[model samples]
Target: MSNWKKVLSLGLVLLVVAVLAACGGNDEEANSEENNEQTEQESNTDVNEEEISIGQINWAENIAVTNMWKVILEEKGYNVKLSVLDMGTMMKALESGDLDVSLEVWLPVQDANYLEEYQDTVNFSDATWFDNAKVGLVVPEYVEEVDSIEDLNEHKDLFNGEIVGFDPGAGTMEVTEDLIEEYNLEFELLPSSEPAMLTQIGEAVANEEPIVAPLWTPHWIFSEYDLKFLEDPENIYGGVEKIHHATRTDFADEYPNVSEYFKNWKMDDEQIGELINYVENADEPIEGAREWVEENQDLIDEWVQE
Candidate 1:
């Protein structure tokens, strides 16, 4: 009786120990699976959290390129927001880290003041998109009387004693102010929006009247109208500038992929000109950008390649 009881008790104890060990193994496996699922979910959350805010000026080129990048980035599964800001506000936003990126910053000449002030706070792209940019007074070809900024005072009456200018704080307007002071021209610069300035210029040109306005290259106006940049003998208006993108100083660290895309971004006059023209004529700027992006998949692929 004692032997049988001992043997039975030993077998029962061994069976219980084996069953408990199996249960513990299953628990460990379940916990491991749960931890793996959580890690995968967190990684996906990080990907979904990748959002970028781009600051864009209302200038023609800036609008075109900013919209184009927005389309491209969104297509690549990024959340992109675009804000139309003035030159001063854009720079300040970049400095304060409110904006992630800006696609237009004319360097070595136009926008020099903003760049100088925000250099420490912002980071510029390694390469420029457009290298041949200019800012100056422009007129229709029919304005035969005024061929140069030096000739403006002689024909100031033609422009109604005021020069058509873009935004008040724009880089071009700032340089135009200096031009007026340096040339001692008897003309006033009327601070107007780009569309307003363009409307006035369009009317003046339509009537074969003379009109002078602050203008920039790579703009759609040059393609739409037979216009020419007035000569600046004094060279107050910066001759040629390279357009570069800028971002917050920490942008690259946070968004390495986007930073790489911007570094690889480059466009010549023709490409940018076509983009501006397309955007200017489209029903909406983003529509035009999407069209351009659709047609340029190969180029976009190169830019977004990791």
Candidate 2:
């Protein structure tokens, strides 16, 4: 109603508006600082400085092979980091270019579909690790008259109508499923970790109890346990596979020297087996592998020599 009263009300409204704007600005600045801090932390955690990062899957052989590569890369004076992941996650990471390399791509078996889908994003090197690498239903030596996958159908009662399996996404597990379906075998494929499955095999072998499982070669278990692969008369399981090395498409160009060494990497069963055994049996994998590489420097040099 009065001029002074109206002017005072207008000033009060302006003051409240200014305070609200200041509070909003402060909140935005705080959010900006938090985002920048997170970005810095992520960059610090990533191995991004001209270093070679490899992706390894869940398998003992994969661990052995990955550590060997890590050793070779370190010896060449380049930083290398390995991220252990499952096959599915590993493939997605490789496709998205988060992971640089995968040394154990068991072909026509695990991740076969992944390779086909992500070939453009990745380049698979020639099989760096190759062997019979067979996957089939294996039994302890005491399974008397059973000799093959087909024969298991008749003796299902003995094995409690079950076949031990490794990780669910494992190549061996995939093949085991096919074998069961193809042969019309009445057995449940129980998925478990490789160590657990192998422990079961060991116990079964010790007691001479009948056991069937998805098994592979060039594995230390063969040497540690007395077992035999049940004959695959139906041939449902695929034939021998060559374990390969794979890298993100830009890997060679991005880290040429490290790529060169990896491209030239190759060895037979004897050489790999020695390292495998050393890593698997020894308490310290990195220390054990490092010692093996140092002792066999001549062989390593031969592979990485320019």
Candidate 3:
């Protein structure tokens, strides 16, 4: 072996090692950047993220109640974003930490599964936004000789043996099914969308026809149409309920000021019912909430102002 051959061989080996090292370093850097981007997206926190995110179920009470918070929060220098979703879906999102807050959780009416499962991950408001919320069968003013669920069995022919219901996933549907089994009532539970059910009831009431449906309080239906909840002698729908706010477990820690605003926030049945009435009967949600806020500035200022 010659000295030049040995030296050249050693230099070649060193050059190959340096090239591999450089390739490895590039790969690591690329991976780090990708991970950073992903984290940023999941967090989705704005650089100027002074806004508070609130989740809202598609019910009138939820929409109105949450919007009331939105108004209060905004007045206190916090921007607010209301994310509207279905009841069940909204609960799942709140449990998974996808949403920030929900102010429409009705006690004993909404599913208990999420409440039990995500108890550790969620926090409920100290004060209830509204009470007197209810769920049960309702009949129009024109429905004579039928004033109770028990009375329905005899008048099956009047309603075609079908009891109209709201969306399939609604808690009212669950209670209605239970009511049927408990009483052994002979009737079909028609699960339809909110709009569909409302349209049917509206038409029936307009023409003085008999109509039955799943109904709740603090809703605009009473204002839109003359209706009465059938006497639930069996009490299958549970008693009066209270609505409150639920947020991520870390919400208070992350946004203390916003949490304080939510904590101090409260409204009576009349205030919230009026808000719902505006959204449903008044045909204007955003405008209605805004007008309500403008008209009731004193009440709002009590919550946020000082």
Task: Give the top-scoring candidate (TM-score).
Answer: 1
Candidates ranked, most accurate by lDDT first: 1, 2, 3
Question: What is the Cα-based lDDT of residue 257 in candidate 2?
Answer: 57
Candidates in order have lDDT scores of: 0.85, 0.77, 0.76
User: Per-prediction TM-score, please?
Assistant: 0.87, 0.80, 0.77
Question: Candidate 2's error at 185, in angstroms?
Answer: 1.4
| Candidate 2: stretches off by over 4 Å | 1-48
Cand. 1 Cα-lDDT: 0.85
**Candidate 1: C-alpha RMSD after superposition:** 3.2
RMSD of each: 3.2, 13.0, 11.0
Candidate 2 per-residue C-alpha lDDT over 1-306 given as tens digits, one digit per residue, 9 for 90 to 100: 999999999999999999999999999999999999989766444224566778876566778878877887776566888897877677777778888888777777654766777788778786455755676778878777799777887888998999888788765677677767888889999998887988898888888788888877777888887788888776666677777778888777667656666666777777777888888877877777887888888877876776
For candidate 2, the TM-score is: 0.80
* lDDT (Cα) of model 2: 0.77
For candidate 1, what is the TM-score?
Answer: 0.87
**After TM-score superposition, what is the CA distance of residue 163 in candidate 3 from its true location, in Å?**
2.0
Clashing residue pairs for model 1:
none
User: After superposition on all CA atoms, how large is the RMSD of candidate 3?
Assistant: 11.0
